[model samples]
Target chain A: MSLQPLACIIPPDLLAAVAREADATQRQALLDTLQLDQSFRVVRAENAARTVETTRALTPRVGAGTPSRSIYDQKHSTATTPGTLARSEGQAPVADVSVNQAYDNFGYTYKLYWDIFHRDSIDDQGLPIEGLVHFGANYDNAFWDGAGHMFFGDGDGQMLTDTTKGIDVVGHELTHGVTQHEANLTYSGQSGALNESVSDVFGSLVKQYHLGQDVATADWLIGADIVGPQLAPALRSMKAPGTANHYDNQPATMDGYVHTTSDNGGVHTNSGIPNHAFYVIATTIGGNAWEAAGQIWYDTLVDPRLRPNATFSKFAALTLRSARTRYGASSNEAAAVKTGWDEVKVRVR
Target chain B: MNLPGSTGDPSGLPDPAHPRDMSDAGLHVTYRRSGGIAGLDLVAECAGSDLPQDHARVARDLLDAPADEPGRGGTEREAAVVPAGADRFTYTVHITDGTRHRTLTWSEGAVPSAAEPLLASLGGLATPQRAP
Candidate 1:
């Protein structure tokens, strides 16, 4: 009488076989039970598949503390990412210069995170670093696809050129992946600006670390090497924010915050506020930017208190907290953090 | 509309009573690309007659399609709500056919396949401009 027991004990195939020989009423019940059991099997299979996918996504593809990098060439087409494998981990340089730049820069970024922060790759799980170069003809931009890949454009030979030439640009895009795996900041409005600023911070740090430059020697410019004649100088200036180029409209302080519908509510424009703050903190600390200053920012990035929708004020306060937590309350690092935010007119309580 | 080679008419016979309006056939398109890593704004404007016949057709078909079409990316509301990607270009395309006008905005990768040629054509014509 109990269909539950029948559904559980009898396999759907056996239940169907039994239904063929049963009485009409019994056969109807058996068929219904078989249908229910079949649905359960589908649900179970789907759940199992989902579990496997989640595990696979979280599982590190390479060994801990080692970077697994792959560089692909798009071959002047926007059709597919990572179009063809031009280089792989521990492989010799290829014929194409862009491929080699991407490969080397990816390694540089990995070294910075690993050597300084002692963190594994982006996800702290040895997530494979994938780079796609030569995407589209004269494409003029570089970006993280938000799905575990970095794409670099060849540039229009006017406003920008050879995006792979900027090591900071590579670090910047890859840091977007790091941010994606961390706070996963909402890429709009104030939080979006924070996301951009974080990228700029780590990006400059990567360059600084590679060059063995102290805060004073570091250029603190985002895309210095990549800009062409049309948009000369650099893409952005963390030290001076709005002075990168003629078209650079970044604002260094809260008083100059630009409110607009374009550029995802001025993410790139307003990021100058935090970018300058980092610049001030690094200079105020007066040593390698990647030392104490970089540690605090990285600490704030992975801190649980840093929310996805964090505003500039929220992020500033968390950085202060990170500074104090890492250093004593009266430590110079914490004081520098406070002074940096105050200089940028961000009130961190 | 009636024409000697017309195949759109439900009847097999050519009808002269409803001639296609030549004025309405003209298309005006404005393309703007913004929000790249360099934060450059580039703009280009063109008339349907200026583009190749195939590209003009694709532009017209893209403008005619509904915003919710699968290949049209997504509705404007959705596009505005979801973040596309970091440092990726955002494109705004406006098309006008006589009195009929439609505008579409999409992040780089979400653009409709049909609009690729039109965008490629316009991108070549684009000049650097500041965002308004």
Candidate 2:
């Protein structure tokens, strides 16, 4: 079966709380909103399945009126495929800015792996990408499924505009598939949380490289553009998770933590810890995340010793070792990892 | 040697748990009675073992008596949980202790899920139940 983003990742409460509105007018509005979302999921899924994968579908096949920045919607049930459920450059392909952004983001992703990693595709085996954009027309949020594709939902004018409004989010979803293949990290508890963190690290790095933004200039805010005015929080904040979102939720740092099943073992929330760790590491070294920080993290992921259910401590140790192994015992790469861990208060011990 | 016989429904299926046993993960039935069976024999060939100890001693004397032993003519059985993966099936055959009159069962490799109910047919086994 194709990948299905779990019900847990995006809590039903957002929709439920809206549905419970006492005002009759508000309730009807919420129902209409939710109905639109469900419909998009169905359509997006049909698209992902129709094509072998997203990148391949894009390759050599310029669709009729393909949005310069088009959004797709993949309707999936769980994590299982080469997933890319949806895409959108901006507002809509008709909207010049949106289309241009979407096309550029999509193109950059294809280019990044082909040039730097020399990976033919997501799977390094010519695996296809499946993306769904403008999901629900105004639904909020975007996610990558083990289903092997991604799905992007437009924000409700208040929370988020469109998932593809940003390139980092796109990279974030694709990176989930990468993490799945390399570590197959169990999607629960701490391991699951790390899975999310890894996605953010790579996702942000992709954007950094594309924009030529350095460690200091990068906003380090994941999904800042994705969130709309009405929403309190963006999808997640790597710099300071809880702070970015409107909710008084704790920061993604380990010291200010929330342990619950709210976000798939807090994959979205807790990912902040390791994300911040990488940010600190990249910022400390003063360059691209893909260089030292991304390489060490990526190398650790493919390490044979990595298990399906590894926590932050376990992952930190692995990165430390990988930095030393790749750059040498006392190289700056290794020291940056040490400092990175120190900043996160997760001792290299 | 071919061990006298090899014909059966599941003669060479891989064991789900740990294979590498004389019984081929409980699929092969060998004559290992005190009558001096020199080597392992298949269930069908078990009739004329080097020991020639007789089927009753090898089948009944070794395993627990069928709950319906005596007049009822019933067969004994045991069940175990599936290990690790979702697809494979296995069984833990019980051994009967002559002195304590106790039954001890051990887990064996992938057994056909279909073989469960048929195990009851071992009863009235005027013939040997070969490695199926």
My TM-score estimates for the predictions, one after another, are 0.79, 0.53
CAPRI tier for the interface of model 2: incorrect
Question: What TM-score does chain B alone reach in each candidate, compared with the true chain B?
Answer: 0.74, 0.22
State the lDDT of candidate 2 residue by residue for A20-75, as single tens digits: 96488888876776776766665565455334333532453323222233333333
Evaluated with TM-score, which candidate comes out highest? 1
Listed in order, the DockQ scores are 0.18, 0.00
Displacement of residue A170 (Cα, Å) in model 2 is: 0.6
Residue-level lDDT tens digits of model 1 in B9-80: 223232354332234357988877778788777788878766656767777787788867886754344667
* Quality of candidate 2 docking, DockQ: 0.00
TM-score for candidate 2, residues paired by index: 0.53
What stretches of model 2 exceed 4 Å from their correct place? Answer: A1-103, A248-252, B1-132
> Candidate 2, residues B75-106: lDDT per residue as tens digits?
22322221221101122223323232322221
Residue A296's lDDT in candidate 2: 81
